[model samples]
Target: MRYERADLMTGMVQEGLQALVDGRHGDPFSILGRHQYGDLTVVRVLLPGALSVAVIESETGKVMAELEPIHEAGIFAGLVGSPVPYKLRIEWPDAIQETEDPYSYPPLLGELDLHLISQGTHYELGRTLGAIPMEIDGVDGVRFSVWAPNAQRVSVVGDFNAWDGRRNPMRLRAQAGIWELFIPRLTHGERYKFELLDAHGNLLPQRADPVARSSEASPSTASIIASSKPFRWNDADWLASQAKDRTREGAMSVYEVHLGSWVRIAEEGNRSLDWVELSQRLVPYVKKLGFTHIEMLPIMEHPFGGSWGYQPLGLFAPTGRHGTPEDFAYFIDRCHEEGIGVILDWVPAHFPTDVWGLARFDGTALYEHADPREGFHKDWNTLIYNLGRNEVKGFLIASALEWLEHFHVDALRVDAVASMLYRDYSRNEGEWIPNQYGGRENLESVEFFKHLNSIIHDRCPHAFTVAEESTAWPGVTNSVENGGLGFDFKWNMGWMHDTLHYVSDDPVYRKYEHGSMTFGMIYAYSERFMLPISHDEVVHGKGSLLGKMPGDAWQKLANLRAYYGFMWGHPGKKLLFMGCEIGQETEWNHDGSVVWDLLDRPEHAGIQFLIRDLNQIYAKEPALQFSDLHAEGFQWAVADDAENSVYGMLRTSEDRSSHMLVMSNMTPVPRYGYRVGVPDEGRWEVVLNTDASIYGGTNFGQMDAWAHRSPEHGKPFSVALDLPALSTVFLRWRG
Candidate 1:
């Protein structure tokens, strides 16, 4: 009986040692460290570089047993009748060290966390799944968790472990497919990544944490352990005031900026301005511009700068190119204090094919679809997310919430929404797959947007969402319950294209294309539109707004000023790119700063002053912004004046007590007397004239004109005004 027991014990020891050597042990905890065998206590350890191993009682510092080397690969085992708590005294070739066994600790992730993750309902996945600092059993450490179901093994590798995958293999949490490990003595700021082995036991590329709040700069894709220091925000009043819906009724004049190139430090090798510097510089600049909000290009972590942060790898992490996550938070807080809201351009449409990113993570299409037809983005050479998967959808939704909740972002401007809505976007025949309904619409993406918007509205009621959808998808701004995608606003791409086309033409040809300026009003009330002359219009050889004007330098400046007045006066919210305000002559270059020196010239400085005044007038006047989403707020006073290259419109307040008359003349020929109809017979004051001498334009219009009772153009009153050449005029009635 004793020999039979001895053989059984020997077999168990051999199996444990072989499993350790092969790296195939599903539960290293069961075989490693100390265990009791009836009357005897056995201790085993696998120290890859150790020359000898001794089992010592942790409390008394007494050696319990010297382990015998059972394998040449540093597998040691011995009998030790020690107390419950013990440590391993490992002797290397040159040094000695003592530490607790990683495998002996209890599971770091709880069952509830595993269940929530598998169910795709973990809203705070960022806090739970990433490298989170914590205190486990009075030991300071970081609890790392990741979801890599198809991986044979996932190990946390970093400087602490000498970048050795074999040093700390995470324990799998059953069918939840989550691997977790709590490494003692691990602290903040340590960079780490998941070293994965595929199902076939082949080594794959190490992947950064998908939910990392911070990451190393581009070209180095490891995720750094974020500090747990609490952020003290002074924007409590700002947050509370935003509880109401601010998209529709509130004035929204947005200034779109590309952070990296907006302003660079010339002394620092032309490096991009950090978030702290932006807080000091950008906030004051936007405030001076009178813009209600600043819509930034995607600030997520992307490897390539040429992509302009559109091809993002880290959805949850802010780009370390600017600064740490806390610095970004500070910037947002500063913006709020200055009464300027910040909106982030979020890219969930596709991700780049960087090997260290989410591409073929764990040797499988975990975050994206397996089939290239459905997963590939042909235009960008990127991979589309598999939004049909519950976890992927949840991850994206969590990303939106993370920015809004943690960073206090006011809105998410979803990028490339048109591409996300269509499966055949930018694809030829046979290059794309149809949905289950045999339609071009991407059903998964549609449902994902609905879910995402619904959750955001429920949790962050103050925040809003905008879609960069160029297509005329019906009900984009409608609520989800009405079978719509549920965006608060959609970019009026049609308006942008038509207006740019119209303005680019000479006055001789503009009369023939009169519908270009009038076509937007046909459906202006659809989907709560935002008229955006975004970065897309000024980049990629599409010259600057000023360059697009087909005239000499003076006419070009005059045309730009006229267009600005027209856009500000037109129905819907406004979004102008950074350099467009100052009439940047060159196309946007992501590598260079805005033409700040251009402000020294009166022509450029005048445009800047005009934009500031336009914002102030737009915000102060209710007729221009109060009922922008409703058709009742706008009416054409002279829509059929294409023959004279002139257009006039009337914007009325909600109560119908006040109104503003806006008229634009496309030609450079000044009209001495142009009859413009008014809403009431009274003194119509010219509040803003784009041709004012203050704006570097030929001052040729009166400040105030009396409207006689003589009816014209189907109105009760008429005013003979001196319309300036190639300029727009704003007239406020004092009835």
Candidate 2:
């Protein structure tokens, strides 16, 4: 009986050694770690280059037992009297290294964490997955975890293991699809990637941690172990004062910026400003410009700088190109301290096909769909997320929550929402798959948006979401309980298109396109809109907003100022791209800095000053902001005077006491006696005149005027004022 048992043990050791050498061990912990057999504890280890190995007491330096090589491949095993805390003393050809056995520790992930992850409700996946630094069983180490259900074996490989896949094969927590291993002495800043083998035993590419908090810079796609040191935020007051619902009935003028190109140091080889530099330069500038918020382009980690961060690889990591993850948090905190909200441009529509990214993760269609018709984004050559999968939805939703919770981001502007909502977006008839209901809409994406928005709103009451949806999707801003998309605001793309087209035409032909100026009012109150002249409008040969305007340099500047004035007074929150305020003459160059030198010219400075004043006035007066989302806030005093290229409208406060009259003259021909109707007979003072001499205009507007009791345009009062050519005027009534 003793001889038979010895033979069985020998056979078990040989089989384990072969499995380890082949890297086919699904549960490395079961065979390699210390295990009790009868009255003795069997210690086993697989150190590829080790000459010899010894088991020693973890507390004391006493040698417990020496392990004998059972196979030529450095498989060491020995029988100790008892199982206790111990470390492996490995001797290479010349040097010796002592480290705690990784397999001795139990599973690091709790059952609850696994359950939450499986159900797609793990809001704190960032802290649970990835390489998390923690002290487990009084041993300081990093717990590496990854989701690779289809992988036959997954191992954590890095400098610690000489980047060898066989050194640290993880223990698979079966049905949950998570593989985790706690490596002792692994601390913060250590770079690592998961080396995965496909189900067919074929080695796949090394993939970065999907939930990594920090990552190596582009070109080196390994994820780094980040310390979750508590950040000292000084924006409590800013957060406390924010309204639970921030989208409606408040002044929201967002200054959209691309961080890399906003300001670059030309003297330093034209390098982009770091996060600290941006906080110092950008925060004060946005505040001084009177913008309530600064909407940044995507700062998530991506391999290509030219994609402008829209194609992100690391969903949880801020791009290391600018600074570390903490640096980004500091930037947002600084913005909040200065009473400016920071809205991140989040891209959940598609992701690039970078090898180390989410594409074909685990050698299968894990994060994305397998079928190209349902999975591919043809326009960008990217992959669409498999939103139908609960785990994928949890991954995305957790990403959104991480920004708002960990980084204190005030809002998220979901990019390319139109693409996500439709299955046939940028696809022909046969190129797309219909949903179970056979509809053109992507039902999974719709469910994702609802789930994402509901959780974000419920958890972070002060944080809101804006949709960059170009379609006329109804109920975008309605509540989720009301069967809507549950976004706080939707980008007014139709308004932007119509208005830009109108301004691009020459003044002589402007009368023929007068409907463009009045067309937006038809759906102005549709879905709590945000009038966005975003970065998309200025790039890709579309030209800068200034370049898109008709006529020579002077008229172009004047038209831009007038257009801004009209936009500010329109019934929607405002979002002007960076450089539009200064009238960037050329198209936006993502590689270069904004044309800051243009401020040296009077015309450019005038445009900047006009935007600043517009923001200030829009914020100060309730009539311009109080009822911005309601049709009751606006009235067309003169909707049909297209022959003279004149448009007039009145903005009124909720209380009906304060009122502002806005008039625009699209032509270069000034109107002497432009009679605009007003609600009451009062002393009407010109609050802002875009064509004033101070703004490099012809100074064609009244400084002070009185509205007569005589009725005009079906109103009780009328004010006759000299309207400037290619300008807008704002008159506040003081009864």
Global lDDT of each candidate:
0.87, 0.89
Instruction: Give the Cα-based TM-score of candidate 1 against the true structure.
Output: 0.96
In terms of lDDT, model 1 sits at 0.87
Residues 568-678, model 1: lDDT tens digits = 989999999999999999999999999999999998999999999999999989899865787998889888888888899899998988899999998998877799788
- Stretches off by above 4 angstroms in model 1 are 1-19, 22-26, 33-43, 51-69, 76-83, 86-99
Write the residue-wise lDDT of candidate 2 on 579-617 in tens digits: 998998999999998999999988888888999999999
Q: Evaluate residue 113 in candidate 1 and report its C-alpha lDDT on the 0 to 100 scale.
A: 78
Per-model TM-score on C-alpha atoms: 0.96, 0.98
- Model 1 superposed RMSD (Cα): 2.2
Model 2 residue-pair collision total: 0
